[model samples]
Target chain A: MDILPQLILNSIIAGAIYTMIALGFNLIYGTVKFFDLGYGALTAVGGYSVFYFYKTLGINIYASIILGAIIAGIIGFIVYKLVYTPLRTRKSSGMVMLVASLGVLTAAQAIIAIIFTSQFQTLSINAGTERVFTIFGGVITQTQLITLVLGLGIMIVMALVFKFSLFGKAIKAIGDDEEVSKIVGINTNKIIGWVFFIGSAIGGLAGILIGFDTGIEPTMGLSLLLKGVIASIIGGIGNVYGGVLGAFLLAFIENFGIWKISGEWKDAIAFGVLILFLLFRPQGILRR
Target chain B: MTKTAKGILWVIALVIVVLIIVNVSSKGGKNSNTASSTPIKIGFTGPLTGDVANIGQNAKAAVEIAVGEINSAGGINGRQIEMVYEDDRCAGPEGVKAANKLINVDNVTAILGSVCSPATLSFAPIAEKAQTPVLSYCSTAPKISESGDYIFRDVPSDLFQAGFAAKYTYNTLGKRKVAIINVNNDWGLGLKKAFSDAFKALGGQVVLEDGDDPTSKDLRTQMAKVKSSGADLLYFAGFPDGTVAGLKEAKTLKLTQTIFGADAWDDNKIWDSLGSSADGVMYTRVGTNSSDAFKTKMKEKLGNDSIVYCSNYAYDGLKILADAIKTAGTDRTAVKNALYSIKHVNGVSSSLIEFDANGDPKEANYVIDIIKNGKAEIVK
Candidate 1:
């Protein structure tokens, strides 16, 4: 049986995850124009929250996921109300906002460590092997298939939100020109707060999905945030659709590059792709 | 004076008063005892923060527990064992600084750790210059001990673990074709080379090799490519975080087959994270200490069901140091001599830990453990 299709399927699955993380990350970056290093930490929060709800509180996993998303959204709102909102009101420079985000990242990470004690934790209800499925000579797991479906569903919903919703127009308006958006009677501050909420909640969903796929640790967010940022940068910064496309492209390049060589070169291939993109198409495939 | 400046001055004065009081109390203990009766101080340095902090924390915890037991057993030769803990943060420069602190400030006679091999190597030169013996619990590279007389390892190096992992995958698992993925670091690179050599020696074909930057998020592409490579099993030589992430992504894409890794995969968290997906994933580890003595000791101390192998090793490292101190009569050359001549010495981890001339454990074997019911179970 040909393994190429299976590898392609796997790469697509990975791309879906990166898309989710990058989509959320880019939303916040587009609105705030500042990097939130703590975006990854929010994912950890979502994962830990779900773990607590399902494993510790004995809630259903689905219920825990909803609760985790809400918790992440609430935390995002707080980040705005407590840190970002005040700083923006104060008319802080981009660098100051960047540093504040760093503070948030460090504080959020430390809180997770203190709460979870940095132990590797997972939520598995049963002792059973993973079920594998094959289609068209390609193999995959049931969980993975679910992830791919969920990713597409989320992407479609986001696309519709951006296209048809009034709030989406305001966001796009702000993305184009924040001052003009405010002058045109768009509640820029309120819209940005909502953006943080939406973006962070999505980030939280990514975290929960990742926790189910891998395990959750306090520091897992940092790496996730890095990938999300890379995908965003590669896809076309500040563009949701572009970010998703970039994530898939990134996944495909890394997965396909090491077709014959040892798996150890996978990451090198990823960075090489990034460097190639930076060198040739710095504006990205879909520029704003 | 401005309000803030006055406040700062007050805080400084308060700090000075506390320091004076502490110094006075500390001096009282010294003045009451003869200078010749001071305890022999040893140092343990390892990463207390960052990604691999858990490993170092376990090592530190084990050392504390073991050293506590030693001191209670009436310190070596009437000279009490004093230990200094350093947070090396797993960096080479940090390791050097930690070693210097132990030597200069703590005045330790020997040094026990610096968890990663690079960190251990960083401190080895300093220890050799200071003429202090160094025993490590986790640093597994073979070259770590090659620096000379002062450096030793408590466990077998990665050379043995990787070779054994490769041999087991080829012979026991009966896999002819394998694809290997490793983290792009010294630990992963070194282990991969060893495993590659051993796997080839066992007449197995390595179809694909790929590396991941620990910080990289997209590995599905490489994993998918491996699925197409027609490898029977996949091996990942990296930490628990990356291993779980990669395996989960690989599974999602339906590249299902047997997966193998080394001691890096023995983490309890990895199994829990993967849920049902973790089942049938096989990894290797130095056999767990299932002895009654180990159980009793763990029950008395940690009160945890999953007895970590690293923590046990750390505990053994401390006990060995303590034994050396006692046998040597002074925390000086005697402790080092006792450690080298250690014969049939026992600890809670293993029934017997007899160090060879090169400071390598005489007996270290790889046991294949499968993820069953979210916990590792011995397959053979």
Candidate 2:
């Protein structure tokens, strides 16, 4: 009975982490309508930035975090301009775009590995193990709590902006029909560039928080992206609310699934759920 | 055929022919007869590139130093040694290619190398078939024991380290119940199985056992089960990245059980990443008896970041091969026989270096070390 609460807590924490990733993934997919695989490697960019600034250079941690996100955003924007924008101009197929994004992903991951040496690095100066809380008999660390709050907080903020803002309408118009969006003087490329910056910033922030919680590694991007992609697919690839729901659902199922079976099967269980969603409910919980 | 395609094929053919000719002439220029002033060809294969290249590079440095020392000390029975280096790049296919070249091309009498276990395992069969003896310096996998009669490793196997860990956790630490979580990879499964089997043999109860993906950073699912396991000790068999995550999550869950690790936990980066949360965590690793003299010599040769734990064994491995060659001459079978006959010899790695029937080092000392304030201290 006591274990149940902790299992739920663990699921919530895991879900929150995935939600950070899925939120950014959905935000980008919603706008561009192409799976931006390079979005994954941007997480490492954020983490390494913080590692260099806060850990190595002895900068203020908060300031370092802001710089990390901004740098990731700028990098994301540059990648879009350099690689993705040309593809968009050519009106390339989604397959071509996906492959291009994969190139971006591979190059970015390699660059980060070259800079950081592919070893696991910790960004948390304070290990954060000391500051722990037990809520409803479920233990949660300060970093984890921050992760949960920020996940939901960012989701709500993005939801409101999408519902009421001009930029949000522009994004939806481009997503619905890029040709129509461009014809309406929406500046599809510029809007998509900003979308890339915003989405990648969120991804970067997820990386920073994850670094504080569990440390960072260059190759972590792929797995992080994988979980988020699964969540986005299950919730509805382009729907933000669907991504959140799918993330929590996936997390809950994964945590509870492994509770009965051995822990070795956790990833197996996750992939199994992904397969189930793909087969039975391909459109996910909400149809875009 | 297309003109461009015909030209490309011709170019490839020419390159292959040129490579073979160059290879033959190089060896012919170096050595003609089996004796006299000809250098004894010894082949070395290891991941001289890629992520774990540092380990291979350290081994290379140690081998180079050994080669220098042996030559300076009037050579191995007056025949100077020449090392043919091949960069395996830590891949299995690469290892096989390197092994083939070392055997068929360079015609090395003995092979010393291949730091990674996969590479060693991959090339062992080819070397065994070719009657070329291989001595691994850094591969600690128990799987290598069955690799071939011609294959031998100076490093103690993970099975030995795991048994030591299990015994230490059960008898020395006086822990009865243990919860083990390991990576699903070969290294993890091999060590984990060895541990559970040994622990069970000792009448210790394993309350929970699970394997995790090597790349996974989140272990809360496993940790949740472990929290309720009521085990006195938690055993982790993993590399550094996973260890950092496991320790941090374990700390967050606030589990009161003592965390124990296998040989993999000897990494300094794990402790650095975990910080104070790593305090009280203990691990059993194959202890080395690297002398101040050896350390000083290594520093003078290659500077800092050169003295990896594996380098100690690498130094000993090269010396063992050289000693075997000196006794039995350059005959591969004689060298193999010499290795089996060779008994206790004190070297940089440990107090004793003796090969058993399986070509594994007979004497292995496991040191129990504990983390305190984010740093490791030998507790035993």
Candidate 3:
């Protein structure tokens, strides 16, 4: 097999994962206009929940995934109600919310490490049983295929909801002006809460998919979060479609950048692309 | 001075007085120990927690078993051996702290420990400065051979394993072209250099060489590169987590190249994670010719059949140290000399062990084990 097809497939697989993360990240950022560092820890929450339900309790994989996502969504909703919402009510600055989220991220990660002992865990029931399929001379596993398909499906659904749904319109209005949206009978807090639930559920699904594809560790959330943040910034922060576009672009560049060089430089190439975009197109490839 | 300054000064003065009194009392106690019935203190450090905690804890258990046997045999010169253990967490700074505490606070005659390479390296200088011998049971980095006369290891360095692996791949397997993927760290870099040099010397070509961060979970890009490198064999140097991820990714890509690895892949967790995908993969480690009696004893002590090779080495290390102490009689210089001149010491891992000038085992046996039916079976 030619290397180009494999590289492209690798890029697509990576892009799919990044897209899922960036979509949920952008959705939350669009509504709240704050960087929720705790969003990263939710990925581990989703992965560990599945490990508990599916692996520990012997539940069906599909049910475990759904329950894992719901757990993540509920955690996200609780964080919003207890921390972010109160801070927003106090009219705190974005930096304060960012710091608070960092605190939450650190605490959650520490707790997970204490429980799981910092060991890496694979979520697969049978390690070598996953089916492989060849497409255009590129080999991909069943998990990778599901990840790509679910990533695209979720992106489209998210876009449609934002475009056509009254709830999404209410979210946009609140994002534009929270006090004005309330005066206009938008119920800003309730809509934002729903947004938090949906966005976090999507992030949780990405986590479950990634856990199945690679593996899970307590510290995996930070790296996944960084990739999603980079993609969102490169595409255009707070723009849903832009985040998706930037994700594939970042993935392609990262994969091709290391074609001849060593793999250790992959992270450097990613951050270098982000710097270039920040310098030339600070609004990203798309403007919000 | 202000009231706050005076308060602080008073506290410092009180602390200094308490320290002086404690120091004098400790010295008096040491002087009273000359009657020769006091317990001989030995300090031990290893990763009791963290990623490599299992290996460290196993080594500790082995040492404890050895100590129990020694005490039952009436101890060295009728003085019971006492071990004070500290957890270094398999990190360098923590190792340094543990060394300092063992040498300065616990006042041990010698130290045993530090299962990982970096921890052993970090503690070597401290042990050398304190004139306390350190016998590391598991650290196998090539640099440890030159770390200091006081620093010794029962495990052979990666220099031997890498050369052995390279020769096996080239001469036995007849692989002309090999690709190397390694973790970017001391052990990995050492193996990469040694393997490549040895393979090239054997008239084999290294087609591709790349490094991955130890914590990296995704390796598809690197795997794709290796797949297209036209190499018949791939030498992967990684720990358990990295090995599992890399092998899984390679299997997903259906890469047909034969995989070769180092001793770290001898772990059961890797096999558990890789399952059937681990079949046909080969790795090398220091061969253990442990007696069945010893194995049974260890399993009984640990309450499981999870004894790794390092545990055997640890058991031998404590026995050797005890012998040296018996011959030298509480003198550090005499014990060092005894260790240098020791000969034909029987160990669980080997029938005889003699230290070379560099404090590594002079002659060591290496075994190549292949994963067959998700279990490691000795091939040679």
Candidates in order, interface RMSD in Å: 4.0, 2.7, 1.4
- Candidate 1, B3-34: lDDT as tens digits: 99999999999999998997776564423222
lDDT of 1: 0.76
- From the highest lDDT down, the ranking of the candidates is 3, 2, 1
For every prediction, compared with the true complex, DockQ reads: 0.39, 0.48, 0.55
Question: How would the candidate models be sorted by TM-score, starting from the highest?
Answer: 2, 3, 1
Model 2 off-target regions past 4 Å? Answer: A128-130, B1-61, B71-119, B126-132, B300-307, B325-337
Per-candidate TM-scores read: 0.86, 0.90, 0.89
Each prediction's Cα lDDT score? 0.76, 0.86, 0.87
lDDT preference between candidates 1 and 3, better one = 3
lDDT (10s digit) by residue, model 2, range B171-239: 988999999898876677888889999999999999999878767878887887888888998998876
Per-residue CA lDDT of model 3 for A1-288, tens digit only, reads 589988999999999999999988999998889998789988999999999999999999999999999999999999999999889999999999999999988888889888877677889976767999888888888998998898889888877877899987888787787889999888888888988888888888888988898888787877888899999999999888899999999999999998999887888999999999889899999988
lDDT score, candidate 1, position B81 = 74
After superposition of all CA atoms, the RMSD between model 1 and the true structure is: 4.0
Error of 1 at B321 (Å): 1.6
Whose TM-score is greatest here?
2
How many clashes in each structure?
21, 0, 0
lDDT of 1 by residue, A1-288 (tens): 576776677677778888889888988888778888867789888988998999889998889999998899889879988998888888899889888888887899889988876665554454224576777777666556676777778778877988999988889888888889999899998899898888899899888877765567777787678777778888998887889988999888766676666555765776777788899988778896
